[model samples]
Target: MIITDTHTHLYSEAFEADRDEMIQRAIDAGISRFFIPAIDSTYSERMLQLKRDFPEHMFLMTGLHPTHVKDDFKDELLHVQTLLKEHKYYAIGEIGIDLYWDQSTLAIQQEAFRQQIQLAKQCNLPIVIHCRDAFDEVFEILEEEKGDDLFGIFHCFTGDFEQAQQAISYNMKLGIGGVVTFKNGKIDQFLNKIDLKHIVLETDSPYLAPVPYRGKRNESFYIMEVLEKLSGLYQLSEKEIAKITTENSKAIFGI
Candidate 1:
């Protein structure tokens, strides 16, 4: 099974001590594809080095994350634009409004999100969104920008059935992660109702670790826990879930 982790900060300092061993562990467990999202210009070199180290498995994206948007956001966007011109990226993402961190930055966050969406349209690339405590806000912008040309994954989606359907209406595949394995992570309640085609697997590793590993640092190999949970929720075999979700990832990332 070729599992795809559509969003993971594999370049995160969390794995600095044993990055290679950690990645190899995932590869040995069949989690081969890793889509790395850009946070800011600061991590660009580390992302590039990761790609070089594991060229076959790593796919890169370029964008300024919502939480990272600040007074110097315009310059950061320029850096993203310049990176786009210089490198081949799979998407423009991990970008969107994140009001949970600092509601005060809402105005600039909205502007950055809108600009990045436009940039994604210009490049004909999918966008991976990072939305938190801003579903209404994110949907509002998506409502304004909806079209055949705008399509991508709603990274780490945590919303109700209505919001899930709305996200689908915008050509977004719901990115199911470790949260699905949590006892109280509500997405599992209505996930089966949504077709498997509309879903993709992820770990958001070193972050939202699945149960049995919850409250601990997550790794790509731990995505197996998520796969097992999804298998039960969807009434499919683990291999089948992996195949379908990996295919869904391909559909979004064009890999």
Candidate 2:
């Protein structure tokens, strides 16, 4: 029963002290595949270094995250293009609208988001969307851009039943993370409407830890807690949840 963490910032500074040990913990717990999403050009070097450290287990994706879209976004996108041309990555992702922090960048974020979607289409790779308080806006663009040619996962998805179905219609799988385990996290209510096939597990570590550690920094090992919750929701065994979600992730990442 190998579990795959479909979205995680393992390169984030939050794990400096025990990064190696934490990864070992996850591996010890049977969480094997780790999908790494790029934030922007700035972190590309560090991301590459991570692959060097764990080539067999870690997979990388290249894209400019919406939150990182600045006045020089065009140039940043160019960097992403160059990086893609130079090497291979699993997908184009962690790219979407982030209106929670600064609404001023909404227009630019959408523009960058659309551009990255085109890039993903061009590369024939799936995407990992990072959505915040801009679901309507993101969905609007997805509605326009989605097709057989456009497909990906909605990373850290916590939307309602209707929204989940909408994302599936757009050829996306919902990335279920720690939020589903929270007592107040609403995805638990109608999650059964979605099958394990349309779902993938992740940690998004150093952020959004599951209940019992909700306010603390998250880690990939905690993904087990998410699997435990899903097992209960689907009335399946943990081993089955791990295998199915891992298979769902391989369907996306092609790992």
**Strongest candidate by TM-score:** 1
- Note the Cα lDDT for every prediction shown: 0.94, 0.91
| lDDT, candidate 2, 1-255, per-residue tens | 788999889999999899989988998988889999999888899889888998888999999988889999999999999999887798998899998988999999999999999999988899899999988999999999988989889999978899999999999999999999888889999998887799999999989999878999999999989988999999999999999888888888787
Off by over 4 Å in 1: none
Q: How close is every model to the real structure, measured as TM-score?
A: 0.99, 0.98
**CA lDDT, candidate 1, residue 109:** 97
- C-alpha displacement of 63 in model 2, angstroms? 0.8
Give me the runs in candidate 2 sitting further than 4 Å from their true place. none
Q: Give me candidate 2's TM-score against the actual structure.
A: 0.98
Cα deviation of 111, candidate 1, in Å: 0.3
